[model samples]
Target chain A: MSTIPHDAPAVIDARGLNKVFRDFWGRPKVRAVQDLTLEVRSGEVFGLLGPNGSGKSTTIKMLLGLLYPTSGELRVLGGSPRDAATRERLGYMPEESYLYKYLTAQETLEFYASLGGLRSRRRRQRVDEMIELVGLASARHRRVGEFSKGMARRVGFAQALIHDPDVLLLDEPTSGLDPIGCRQVKDLILDLARRGKTILVCSHYLADMQDVCDRVAILLDGRVCAQGPVRELVRQPDTWRITLEGVDDALRDRLVAYLQEQCGRPVAVEPAGRSLESLFVDVVTRQRAASPPP
Target chain B: MNLPRLVAIVRLTLRDAVRSRVVVSLLAALLLVLVGLPLLVQSDGTPAGRLRIILEYALAAAIGLLSAATLWAGCATVAAELQDRRLFIVLAKPVHRWEIWLGKWLGIVVMDAAALAVTGLVVAALVAVIRPAGGADSQFEALLSARDTFHPDWAAAGLVRAVPAAAGDTRQFEPKSVALLPGHSLDFTFPVSATAPGGPMELRARLGSARPNRAPFASLWEFGPPGKPVSVVTSTNAPGLSMALAVPAAAWSPGGVHVRLTNPVGRDPATLVLGTGVGGVELLVPRDGFAVNLTRGLLVVFARLAFLAALGVTAGCLLSLPVAVFVSIFVLVLIASAGYVQTVAVTGMYYIPLESEAPELGWLDRVVLGVFRIMNVATAPLIRLEPVALLADGRRVAWAIVAEAGLLLGLAYSAVASLFGLWFFTRREVGRAGTE
Candidate 1:
């Protein structure tokens, strides 16, 4: 979990959380969240990983009080989600990047800042800071309606951080972003975590989760299937590999036989090296390094 | 709880609306309908007449159009923002749900009011410019024309002559003598001479009516002024006809001769004065007329607009945009048609067959009719109270506006609640990354 000390109070705590939705015909349609038990400690980047329709969005919605759970004990900043006072300590960036299309990037930030009860002077400062922080300063005057999806997502991130809340819940923060934009968002999440903000990030990009998250909870069919530190979850045991060049056929056969005798199972030999895809990625990375920055 | 914050939210909402092209387009359309239509249809006539017609049409159109626009704008205020999830960002903050609701509601109300005022002023200005310049002069000319045809002509003249015939003759006069006598005239004396000789012969006298076929005739003396009275003789041969050989002294006058028709029958006869000095003649006939005073029409239009504004606001609160507009317009149409329907029904022009007596309408229709009684009600008082009604009417319009404000505030509260809920709900750990 990124070496976070366990003694800190969990920024988010929930027990026995459940949410049920009914269809238009008044029949129970789906259980979007079920018996979810989780804790997000302070100063950690937590990722929620799931496939489509896996209750990732639903759990996020319930956390934000956009939808009520069927039954649960949940707390953010040690208070009810529906409570206004509790909301002051939280910020959320929805999965869809919902924003007023008529407002410019700056206006959007200012509006959210106002809602956060920030005073005018401080709101202006915070707006500028956020715009620059999200790398939207150059396009701050452009209406959100004219912005690209990635740019709009950046504005969404800016609004979520306008109030500088204690916790940030971002749903699919980098869903539609290009590589550079995704990296920027990942870097922002890391920066926010480093500044002692607790963040719950929901994304489908497992590589992104592996790169940035201190821990992750994988959801399937409205329930978390597994959750822990990414490295620990994917850790392997008793697996060894050796690479050698110019080995004779007799030496290869002897090595294989020796290993097979040493272990109770069949010892197999294959190419011992980095994956081709990884090598290719490294080659592209080096090629890009050869070029000047745009 | 935070009034300033709420105000800020409201300000932002109004700003957003002002910047929205949809609202701008709708407002522009409303303004065009209010101002342009009246000017286009305005008749080239006296200011009062033009005003009367334009005010009537413009007021109706403005009230309908503006109310609809405003109500529609109101319906979209919350539902659209929520649908787009833009509300989610705002609600995620520390704002209250009620504040959001109130802010959105206020934004819509302000927009509607702006539209209403612009349209109302346009109609009012049209009315002001069209009001008749002089009220009494117009009324006097109308009355004079109404009284002209009823006055009768009082000057007319006719001559009378008498002829004498011989006694024992069956004919009152020979055909040759009848030709020498004057045409029909009022007979003041009876003729006694007929054959150039005085004799006490009874005269068979006939009075001709105005026409020749069936005329009333009177025997008269041939001597003296055409219309002067003379003695009449009963004999047919007398040169100067005399009645009892005496003539009344007062019958003759210097200026003109007097003529009178004495009815032999005892029944009273009707007479029309035919002399220049005729007096005390009166003519009466039934007449039909219609008039529209522009000032009164203006007052009525204003009253209707006020009523409609209230109704539109109320409808906005109760239903979504499309439904609210439909229902409100239907109500307006029904109300406008009530008078025409009632008039046709009262006059037996309605042809519905009745199997049984129709049930009387209850209090709801009564109240609607009472409030919108366009024809018979005292419209001035209502017009005078337009300002007060807008502010104080307890009906849905006023209450809807109030409730809308409340709803906006409620939205703000819900927004904040939603944010908190999202944060709380998402923070939980389902279990490991894939195997709960």
Candidate 2:
């Protein structure tokens, strides 16, 4: 992984990719992906945004080589996604945990590590690191069957990263996680991107995409409806929001009147506040700090 | 190709089998078959009968139970995981699809090996403990030791081409065709160059009389060389008879041991017909111990399980759980009923035509016969492995037969099944995330 140049070619590249699922008679039933041209650059965090049944999971499966496109080109790590070497450098977390119920958390990670071609010592080390990173150390020895949905998700996340893959295609990474786990995952994604790891995340959570994505492609019905940097895609030049600090009631009223006269319309003013996610995290952090687990 | 990945999948599969209590269930079933079967079967008071009960009924029941358990486990290990969506995690790794197939096979084989070893030891111990206390000693010995059957080489002895000149019969003295006249006698010899258990040798014979009544007749046997023959008298009326003769060791010549059957002038001219081929005459020579022979039989059974495991896994790889189980059971039944298939294959017919003396075939019979023919081509070698019968009858389960089973069932059949399985599994679209 380290041998690759920092300015390497795009890790994920697809052009006019189409996937048409067929019925028993081979007649096209659903065009799950159509004319989907997208590029995810090296060291960048990319997001696939769409609503339910909007080809998000389908596109992710294609990128992971779980499905083949009906037509056009698709590549990951400058080679076909179906290539074993390309898959070796990739990590995938599916929508569900899909873990072996009989294996403990540590065993699951170790199993994945072995599949990643790690030797005995390195596999053990990686398993330990992954369990610790996922905050599953305390429950590492417990079978995954006994874990809650959130814990299973955590284990899933750990397994995906146990190989320290250079690229990750995570579908609904935070679906079953609590706010804390979600925050930790988002932070971990950012940290991984900072270390030059290319990540492609598929999620319906707008805030999560906004927080970590350097670039995003929003799809609808198997086509990319929008693509660009997060700011560029969401920005509206005609509208603006300004937050003022330490402004009194009189100053605020005068400023709003001046803006209304200058714009030739009535101006609206509201206090800028922290997002609900941030507030919840703050409350949870403080409470946990007040009475930490022994 | 990837050793670690293969090992991991196999380990995980074994863990699943253990955690799901499949291993426990199989052990319990094997225990029930081994312990409960003796009580289920009423053994005759004779030691030979009791030993036959153990070797035939108990061992067969154990094999049947274990075979079912093996097939069920093989099917469930793969099919259940696929249905439960647990395979996605492993498939998502950098492992080949064939590795998964091979791994599941290895796990099932290991489980079967352990189960067979434990159950076989238990049955063997039970057989030893319940052995009758010193009665019908020869029959008991026959059941415990493997004996090689030797028949007279008639062609080598130049008897098949000979014509009895005294009666002026030009026909050859072939078995079942030859009729010894009242004044004439027939001579037969078998080479006993090999060591026989230093005791009286047993001769199994089937003699038919030309008389319409098939009345009881007295026959005289002269054992040893022509110069010095030991005489014995025995009455024969049935098609099959067993006669034990004690002759001095010195009586056996370097050429072979010779025995002559003569009929003194009876009430009417009596005729004797010898059985054709080896069936007419045989010498049973004890070869090995019962324990070793039992182990060889178990090895053959294990080879059969290997083939069954491959079959179940292949079915599971391609079909749903219920369908796979049904198909596997169907295959098991077909294999167990191989004797019927063999009959059909050889006779080239299925239903015997009652209207005619010979078997006649209809169109449907032809189709069924064709199917049986193809099945026999694929399964004849496996079908010939009658381990339970061999063990009960104290016949040697030769290493050559074991090797043949390993080659045909263990290697060839398993390889074919694995190829099909890997192909289906690799092409299978695992896109459905939900469990079936």
Candidate 3:
């Protein structure tokens, strides 16, 4: 609930970022990322929200230095993402689940751990811890190829955390997950943030981001349309709703005018109030609260 | 340099590759052929010959299949992972792109090399076991002592009787009058000859011993006008004639006469006389003159496999899996068929023997030949450097193997680069919620 310090240096920093893709004939085909700038400070969960083809993944790729930006100054952990030292402190989970089908959950973590420069003993230990952390300890010996979508996602999460990275860049971490899996991922993100890890999450699930992320950036047409603290941006100003039974048009108009005069803002009348999702949440909450303890 | 890290990466790559059913199946198939072929070819001939045949066929099959598998495996190992976005997790780590590429290539090379070594050893052992029992000396002697005699259609006439001894003499005999076919020639210059007052004798002679003796000889009579009457005479110690004489016009016959012989030192000498009817003259010829060059065959196979594999890997890197495989296999077949096509076309040219004279096809033929010539020039370098050419000789096979390994590594690196480039371009952020 506490606010992140504004003075803290951003773990990820980008300025005037641009990525242009050219066809085989050397002509520009798509301006995947335009001049864009953004920052994410330490110990904060910054979400990059966008629809498909909105350059969210492109921006993330550039930030990770998997791709060289057409023109941009981007840094991770105060160093170039392409730099080994910088990369060692960073973790990434792509939008697609890409675990080696032949590798078991433990092996996947171990392989990644080795790449991150962990010694054998340390790698084994870290892999174990990661498997437990991602709640994949029971299935650590199972090949990733045999895993379901949700299980593969868990393995991916385990690999990302295997190195104990300072910065975590996850692309659709909760995608193709069951409700329980989604909740677990959300909790994991929150837990990592609590551990003072800087997390950059790109996902289409706005509601999930609203619940877990401290701040969110909405990208549109290769540019950020809106970005700020989720709570602050979503807060409605002087907005009120009332439900009336069998209300006539004249009474509604009169009541609207009176409310506007009193509040100095428009008052809307509706036939109902609660959103279906909110009702569902309330029902689930009540059921959980009423259930007997195990 | 992080040796442990590199080793770990290589181990991981190999482990991952082994788990791929495609790789496992291909390797299994190769092993099956390698083991099965020798057993099947065990009965063909001596262990060496059978081994040679089996090894030749097995190596050919292995090279083709393994090359294809290695190329496909190399591309699929990295490219598929990237396509499926699985590589992001590994790339996300602290590993360098080059290291990833190197590790994958090492894994492929290790697996392929292991397979090749096993197959090669099996072939060598089989060949050793099946080789012919005789040593080189015996084989060589057998080759050299083969007869130089020739078969004749007509049966020789009359009995060849050994004459009995006459006082202090060994033996003597005479040949009866023999008719000759027109336009035919005969040479007769014995070690000792004398006319016996039958008919005007036709003497024809030349220089050289009758047998293949190392000594030289001189002619007794000069070749002269046909049908001239001259009594034939030769020294008792004169050498055998080396020349043939034609019976230009007349067919003179002598009633059976004795050909007397005596030693130059006044000792008795053995003599034999033979009779013959009309006959045609012909020279005896040897038939077994050609030898097989095994090295050439081996070299051709090696070069073909290496070239095909290289192109396959290149194509795989440049195109998608299915298209690359198809195109590479097609090119391999095309190249192999090219030799035969060239032979046929050249034979056709010889058959006609005058392309320029055929007005209707002159330009077309010229253009075709020109294209073929250009192709020959372009392919000459490839042919010279082909794996087989490099490895044809026993001494060079080692170097050829090394070069082939280098080529495979190069192709693998190129494929990784291409896949990485593609992955880099297509990757993008879909939403903010998934970021760390």
Candidate 4:
């Protein structure tokens, strides 16, 4: 369901990016990133995959202008990422919530909305919309410091989208969420992609990423080890899976035997099962419907 | 430039300070000190002395407490957030670095203003509730009233040995000394411009002798021209003690009036060696009331607090929380010892020279002064008027002094610190992890 055209313009462009961390004495200590070249086009959900300390965060920081590349050329939204004008159209959610503990959810959203240059009336509307979007309307008046990790994450997500930015760089978008929350976040990413927003997500949750990402890059030790369309990268070319409902064991056996005889090869058949995330979402949906909030 | 954005940041900062209970604790401490300080201290048994003790010590305590808190909060604001990774979200917004700096500074200043107002009101209320006894009013009137103080025109009287300080010197750090022998008259002329024969004035004289004058003597003080003189015999002659004698309104002549103090109006003739230095012999004309004077004094304190706010924010921008706090406290110490810094700049004596010791190198003075001058960008000419002392001593905190302090400390010096902060923070990489 990728809406990206072949001739889509690049929203985030990086070429031969390198980052070398230095010690107190200005000596090169660790090469966090080496020779990275990445392009995230408009209207795509691009996922970055890596183990801990594999330069994923460093690359994202560079793209957000939080850290300078030791050597590279980077363009975000067709301009230098450090520019305020360039930042105006970009939204970012850090790995941690990183919100003011003293502020309530409503105040936090309103603060970001104002910073994004929303007028007073529109800011109120957006704050209300974002609170509802994140399912935190009941908890809007409570201080963020009192929120659980998942609730704080929800607030963080709400703030990032408050400005209605076209490009989003989300670090670990579903780090501490429950299964239903994870599914909702994945669906939200797909919905945003459908609306022509470019998103760059970094996470270790491959299953969550696989459900939404169109293209993915797997990084190891600061370098790209593998990259391509998710379908092509994860596709098993030598095997196939077929599923049919209402097939008894004898009928299934007969079909398998006929396939093996015709192909002159041994074939195996197994039952298809639903993903845990899907089942969990279904259960939560039924429970919520049974006893909805008044 | 973005008013709404800055306002948002300011509101958040203020809310943070209040919720964290830091500002509340500070306010409580200030209130206790202002109300409790007078009750604890022992005054000179006189009502005026008691009032002076309360005003001086309580106000000083308030200023000291507020200043330390302002610096501590300033240092902690940005540095703590950065360490906690809270700044990542804020910085990711479309904010220029200068706006953030300005917003935080404004927040601290607003907090200080509110704190000062509370402390001032408490002190004023204390004074009102414990009104002084009836007889002491005239004694402390000249001290508490905001008046234009005038000293004897020593240059015109040919008693001055060196060049006099220029006109409008707000704080006359040095004093003018004059001598008067027994059986001789000392004419002290004060040329003050007032609409001829102006508002009632007083002659406040605190003259010292080579030896303490234990015995009382009769001295004839004649005001105005000899043709129509208003002769008054003042007999209280404790030389070191100050005495305020009311001058008749008619005593002020067209241009100026000369007061001739002839010692020994009787046969006793106790020599009044007039050592006019510091709180010396002077004329006082009431210009404004006590409330207006206190307001002016508070304005100076506000300017100083604003400067400290900028300095603290700038320090926070460049360092970690603990390090920033240390650096800010060090700067605060330096500012607190500004008088010492000034002494080093003027006399170039880092240490008092030992008896018969050789003078240091000639270049030493230049170097010391140069260093202080360089530091002037960070700590401008603050505390020049010593508003607390002025308030306690009953001297006027002139509008000229207020304007000077405001422009230099609040506006000009703060702008420099803020500019440096903005430049460094803009170029700094806030997301830099530890090396490697």
Candidate 5:
């Protein structure tokens, strides 16, 4: 994917999309998504956040063409996702690892790569790169059926990236991963976005979304309750946060008294603290480095 | 359209079958039917009868077992994948739905071909073991050779007329059989190849009496040139007796094989009626070897398998695993019993109707019978492909018959099935209609 401007064109666009699942007799059973309109710009990370049965997964499925919209339009790469040619430039990692139990991790990647239109030499090269990228080098030959949930998710992630697709629809990217794996995945999302790849992440991990997503749409009860850039949506206009260094306790008490006299309201000042995620990442990194896993 | 994609699906299907033990189970079951059945089953104490047992019973059993396996594999290949949700990832890739359907079909067809080849080899070996000790004996010649038979020219012999002679002549002679008077003589002529080597040939006929008691009857026969005739007399009390008599191949003159029959005036003379159908009144001349005929028989069976594979795969495209298998077996049963369907369609019954004189059908019977009649028309060609029966009788499985089966069963029917399957599956929502 080539580098693009900050305002890159929307690669995944949906307008007033509605998905109403029907029962066996054709009566509407559940309206999973309603007026679900969103756009994922190229070279950006877009997160779809919602709770269970809140239409997050359903919307992702419609974007991937696994489920058709009941009304309105949905397009990926400026074409119908149902088209084979359009899917060639798309990758998807489902929430659950739906892998062939009979195949090795390496074979799984090969199968997807081949279906993704890779030739023999290119397919081999990509399969190798993906296996290595997912840290499955040692388990490349092991049957995916024998893998743990975390390992299977890694395989799923590798398969999605095997074709070097320009757009990735990843559902619950860090659902089954450890802290390190989660951090690694969040870093990969950032890295992919830097390389001008469009990514649509669907998950309930609010902190993970805050770390990686540039824009987000929050769905509740089959409708988009809120949407915008993360900064714009989370910013509080009436408040300001300031971090200061080298201030003595006596001087800080005097400054707090002056602010309280100026505003005629209670004033509080506190030292800024590092986020727990950063601390966890630091502890894990140093421990792994010191142990040098065998 | 994409070759690599199709190859990938086919490879995946093969691996699934192998890992799931489906292929191994099928091979073991086929071996039991092919090798074990021949050794354990009892046959009439003759080389020909033993060979018949192997060709007819054992080979048919092998075909039956393989057919079931092919159908099961075809269904499971798609239905199981869909039910398990493995197709979610694959379908999310740039693969067309037809590629998935066709690739699975090709995989099953390859497995079927390999199994059938194994079955053919084992059956051939068994037949070789049961061959007569002295290769020059009559049983050896009859069992190992494909003989061509020629029937009587009843029309030329004035025994049967091609058209109705007078109005209301409802004597049932249109299908052609003659009732010879007590002492009256009837001349029968069988046209032979004239160049069909001059050796000993056999004459076979289904004989019966027209009397109410169906009493015993005797007949005198003379074969060869009218000048120097070889005479033989044969008798039997069983009505509709299947008789095989030896005739010297030299009896085939430039004109043809000529035979005359007479009812010896007092030799329990009852009016005799002879069948003019196949093997009714004919001379058998050894033409080819049994090996070639066996291969032709196998080809016919392969054609049959192709149709069945198409049927199973198509059924799997729409139904779940259990339901797909049920539909496949149901269709297979109906197709296998096409001949029976035809008979019942005509008589409106399989059993004899008791006190009411004849069977009658209600509305459901009428509709069902109508549907079966239509199916009979469509499956007529399939029913005619009787390879096992022909092979057992040492009759020639002609190349023309094989070509017909290949076109009708293997090509036309399979193409139609594949077209419908691909169309239906391409439109079907892959994420729907599964166990989930």
Candidate 6:
């Protein structure tokens, strides 16, 4: 029931969203967001891509009601973003791990759970589950200030999901994360999307976005330059890539020559190796697996 | 609006105060001040004086330290969180902004109450342990008990008119302020409401001489109604010396009592002037126990600190950490100096010594005084509610005063500050860091 048809009504709908930073005299300073019209279907993984100061964070802030747009219409969960009731179903994780440093991981999640109106027993249960889910079980009792950047980000992520919200707005979710943390976060996003949670992620990690995001909108200087399904946008009709197994150097050379003869151009040949992130993750995982934490 | 969210914020605030070592440091500082202060300040060497020193000076210093710590904690709780970006998480939650302000204020108040209770207990225990042996129980009771002051009903006695002292000295004095000539007596009648407990009362008088010479003068004080003097005292006093007389309950009537002070014909022909204002002519009657008096004093002090906590939080909500602290401290200094402001407002002059050279119109002084007048109107109640002077002098801190303080300073002032803070904090742009 969480997933809707391709033409289903939009859970997040914004049209002509514009946010302009102003000076003391009300003169327009920086147009942080401009003519932003976007939509994400129910239970979809949407990515917002931009370089620094390209309105990605600004857009996320607007959706979360942290910042008001200069001129636009933004609705989250079928109501204005400023509505407190609407926020009950929305969760936001900011760019930085904005958590109380003095609170332990469990306490941090518990606090957010309470804010989300979770009852006492359920709050405690969810806090425990979140700690486990974030892989912070060992450091659950440690103060967040003492955690490393990746661990803090995990706690931040846990707090955002503590309420079991319908929609998640994450800004630079994997900025401080290591490769393993980033991989875990990506998997978690995919899992949440599978469980029918609408997730809008803003990040510069193009590969991670490509891996988990169903659709993406690339922003350049406060404007959307391209937006479509990840597969649809990245596909090329003129290029073809083929992978083969058990082929020697002579066979590989023959295949490339045949392709070039057919296409009337030189065919580029390169071995497909594992990504560095995958290699690092594999090495760390195998080492940790060989010597499991006690 | 969300009670659970409010509780969560309060709990987190208290936890931060504890984990940051602010509470521990505050307690340590208070203990050092309370226990070590008696050693530093010189007492009168008598047991009564030593006890007074502990109760008056040490307790005052402890309360001051507690107040400062409360303000610091209040500022750090809100402003530091905003600067550190922790508040962004809270704001992003479904909690209302007012809940956050109230929670932080409650946390500071609860912590303040704990500190105050502990300090009170320690002081009381110290008093119990170090009490001087063999001191008269009556003396101790008189020193420690809260006593109400009864002033003579000058208007009821038709003595409201001011009598001229001498020719060309246009300064008129109250009829009760008369200087008695030899063999001439001045009678003062005071109405006693039935509420006043009938018992032994203490009468203190400051005798002033018309002559500059200091010499012993004989005078007689008669108590009770006409021709039915229950108590009569004939005493000699050096010029300008203060004296105390004890009158038994038999001298008092349910309706009223008349006391006649007569300068009996003596070797010194100089007249004597009874003091002026409440201090000039009054009766002391004991009321509440020392414990209740101390509690009332602490309550008023707590109310003041609660107001400060709200103010600190309000400032912190708008300003960064250092700037918030500075503004809070500045406001504290202004409130504390209300006495000077009051003087300026009343006299329309900042310096009393420059009165002769002061401009007749004094436009600049008038402007400053006008501003201070408004400030004094706002701040006088808080300054006057300080119980230190009353407690030191063994006078009762009236419950009415305590109630007024709670209503005006605790509830009203804090509510206004909290509203302002919530308004500013909610509308503020938290996405930008380190903003004013």
Largest TM-score belongs to which candidate?
A: 6
TM-scores of the first chain across all predictions? 0.83, 0.95, 0.84, 0.97, 0.94, 0.97
Q: Taking the tens digit of each residue's C-alpha lDDT, what string does model 5 give over A1-294? A: 223456679999899988888888999988889998898888989989998889987777777777788998998999998888888899999988989988999999998998899999999999989888889999999999999999999999998998899999999999999887898899899999888889999998999999888889999988999998888899999777767788899988888899889879987676878888789989989998999788
Q: Please give the distance, in angstroms, between residue B429's alpha carbon in candidate 5 and its true position after superposition.
A: 1.5
For each candidate, what's the DockQ?
Answer: 0.28, 0.66, 0.34, 0.83, 0.71, 0.76
User: What's the true lDDT of residue A258 in model 5?
Assistant: 91
Residues B98-117, model 3: lDDT tens digits: 56655665666666656555
Docking class of 5: medium
Q: Model 2's lDDT to the true fold?
A: 0.81
Query: Candidate 5 lDDT, tens digit per residue, B1-436?
Result: 9999998888888888889888888888888887788678887777777777788888989888888888888888888877888888888888888888888988888888888888888888887776666674676567566766688877667866535568965553546566777888778788874576435777787777877775667777788766577646555547787877778766777677888877667846688777777756777776778888788889998988888888788888878889999988887788778788778766667556786776567888788878878878777777798788877776778898899889988899989998988888877765632234
Model 1 misplaced stretches (Cα beyond 4 Å): A240-294, B39-44, B124-436
TM-score (2 decimals) of chain A in model 6: 0.97
- TM-score to true structure, per model: 0.60, 0.91, 0.62, 0.92, 0.91, 0.93
Rank order by lDDT, top first? Answer: 6, 4, 5, 2, 3, 1
Query: What RMSD value applies to candidate 2?
Result: 3.9
Q: Which stretches of candidate 6 lie over 4 Å from their true place?
A: A1-6, A23-28, B134-140, B161-176, B195-200, B214-216, B223-242, B247-251, B256-258, B353-358, B433-436
lDDT of 6 by residue, B79-181 (tens): 9888877887787788777788889999999899889888878877777766656545555556677878888876665666546677765663455476778
- Sorting all predicted structures by DockQ, with the top scorer first, yields 4, 6, 5, 2, 3, 1
lDDT of 2 by residue, A30-90 (tens): 8889999998888888989998888988888787777778999998888877667888899
What proportion of the real contacts between chains A and B does each prediction keep? Answer: 0.66, 0.65, 0.69, 0.77, 0.82, 0.80
Better of 1 and 2 by DockQ: 2
Total backbone clashes of model 4? 1
